[model samples]
Target chain A: MKIGIIGATGKSGSKIVTEALNRGHQVTALVRNKDKATKLFGGTVTIIAKDAFDITKQDLTNLDVVIDAFSVPLGKHLAYQHIDLAVHLVHLLRETETPRLVFILGAGSLQTDDGLLLDQLKKIPDSQAWIDTPESQTHELDFLRTVTNVNWVGVSPAASFVDGPKTDYALGKDHVLYDANQKSEVSTGTMAVAILDELENPSVHQARFTIRNK
Target chain B: MKIGIIGATGKSGSKIVTEALNRGHQVTALVRNKDKATKLFGGTVTIIAKDAFDITKQDLTNLDVVIDAFSVPLGKHLAYQHIDLAVHLVHLLRETETPRLVFILGAGSLQTDDGLLLDQLKKIPDSQAWIDTPESQTHELDFLRTVTNVNWVGVSPAASFVDGPKTDYALGKDHVLYDANQKSEVSTGTMAVAILDELENPSVHQARFTIRNK
Candidate 1:
């Protein structure tokens, strides 16, 4: 399968690229910094140097799947881009079902025993600095729910998303998943694996799912 | 004030153009059909012929307010354009307080004593044909509510929006308004007046309001 990964040089994006390549799939790295993408993936992947907002339908029509792993640094006042870029991509892909879109959402949208995880996050001391990203991603999922004609799905990580190797993963829908030890965490490698498996097997559609390391 | 109306030749849009011009404000008619716009507001208003999606930030930066009266014909498959165009315009105007936006939304999003008016709209007999318009407009309001950086306000008319001259109007926030006669209705002229009044007075920032005939 031909796969395109937006923000292919970022944390989860880079890992998804490697995982797709290791599975013998053709990978296209859509990145703003060609130099950084080339340094990260070298000659193994195709690189399209453009901002996520500038990616056109022509660039995506040839692929079987596109993973939106785009992220922004916290406290930059640029968090709204999460929702904006999702809308842009969905608008471009309306009335089509070929290139499946996988939006890497945030855990704040996940349901907790109390209300949303976002409600708890808002209560964290000084959470105002980085709360906008998760809040906007929650809105992103809300917007996606209204879309019916597009073939899109959302994947959210657990409360503690960190950098590590793959492990046995547990998957759930719309809720905060936890391991037996009560740890709600997922590594980038596990996320990449779960996303790839879902892409190949195709279970969830038009809804979001969450992943946690076992 | 310099005002731009996106659907300057349509029902509510034409009335808005007339009302703005009557108030001695400079009006720019932004329409897709140049001939229709010229025929509607010949010599009285400036015209920019372009699709709402094609409108750019540079085109809007000069205007004090841009009224998004864009609408699709009922029963057409183009209802999603409501949310899509709103997202596009909001994305362009992000981080700028200038060019305050007034969105002409549908009454489906207004609150009833039971729940959303959209819930009642869904129960109408054989409503599948035209329900998409209101459904998508409701989603459009949902998307706009998430946006905090943009200076945008939404206006929803009453249950039966019709063609008529101006009338004394009553306003309410987030709920369906009813006249003393127990009828929920509003004329295009009344909607136009309420919108222009809101735009001039600079009230109701980043929120939604509904209007009905008194």
Candidate 2:
């Protein structure tokens, strides 16, 4: 299958691109800088360099799937770009079934036994400096929930999302997933594997699911 | 004050444009067709011909306010355009106070004694034909409520919005407004006056308000 990965030079995006290529699927790296993408992928993938907002429906018509791994820095402004870009892509694909969308959202929206994960995150010391990204991503999912005509799926990582390699992982819907050790964590590679597996098999539709390293 | 009215050729937009001009304010009609705007306003207002989605922050930089009176037909595709356009405009004006954005929302989002006004509208027989517009507008307000960075305001009319001459009206926030006769209605003229009155006085900020003929 053909795949397009937005923010293909970012941490999660690069992993997803590598995993997709290893799976023998054709990959297109949709990034803002062709030089960076070419350096990273080394001609292993097609590169479309432009702002994600400038990507048109025509550019996505031929792909089988588009993974939105776009992420903003933790402690800067423009966190609202998460929701803005999601709305932009959703608007472009309204009522279309082909070229399914896979959005990587934060775990802030997950429901916990006590309350929302975001509620707990907000209670953390010094969380205000970077809380807008999760809050905006929550709004992104809220906006996506209202869209019934699009073929889209959302994935949320565990509470302690970090950098690592793939491992045995468990999948659940709308909850902060925890492993047997009561640890809630997922690696970028683990997320990539789970997302690629789902994109290839196609289980979820217009719904959000979560993953954690088991 | 110099103002920009999107969908300036529509029922609500036309009325608002006329009211603004009559009040001796400079108005710029941001419309899709120069001919339609010229025919309606007789070149009384400056015209910027473009789709509402294509409207940019540069086009709005000089204005004191922007009234998004953009509306789609009752029962056709692109009903989602309402929410889409709102997101687009709000996205362009984030973190800015200049050109305060005013959204002309639908009455469906109003709270009622039972639940939301949209919940009742959804149960109406044959409402499936035109319910998408209200549903999208409701989503539009829901989306707006999460936005805190943008200087914005939203206005919803009474349950029965119609076209007529100006009249005295009362204002409320959130709930569906009703007159002494228990009739829920507002003419385009009355809505125009209430909206312009709010714009000029700058009472409501970062919130939604409703109005009905007194």
Candidate 2, A131-213: lDDT as tens digits:
99899999999999999888999999999889899998999999898877889999999999999999878899899999999
lDDT for B141 in candidate 1 is 96
Model 1, B50-164: lDDT tens digits are 8788898999999999999999999999999999999999999999998999899999999999999998999999999899999999999999998899999999999999999
lDDT of 1 by residue, A54-126 (tens): 8999999999999999999977799999999998999889999979999999999999999999999999999
Off by over 4 Å in 2: none
Error of 1 at B115 (Å): 1.2
lDDT value, residue A109 of candidate 2:
97
DockQ of 1: 0.84
Per-residue lDDT of A71 in model 1: 90
For each candidate, what is the lDDT?
A: 0.94, 0.93
Clashing residue pairs in candidate 2 are: none
Candidate 1's C-alpha runs over 4 A off are none
Query: Model 2 scores what on Cα lDDT?
Result: 0.93
Judged by lDDT, which candidate is best? 1
Residue-wise C-alpha lDDT for candidate 2, range B1-214, written one tens digit per residue: 9999999999999999989999999999999999988988886999999878888889999999999999988998788999999999998899999889999999999999989999999999999999999999999999999988889999999999999999999999999987778899999999999999998898998999999998
Q: Return the TM-scores of chain A for each candidate in numbered order.
A: 0.99, 0.98
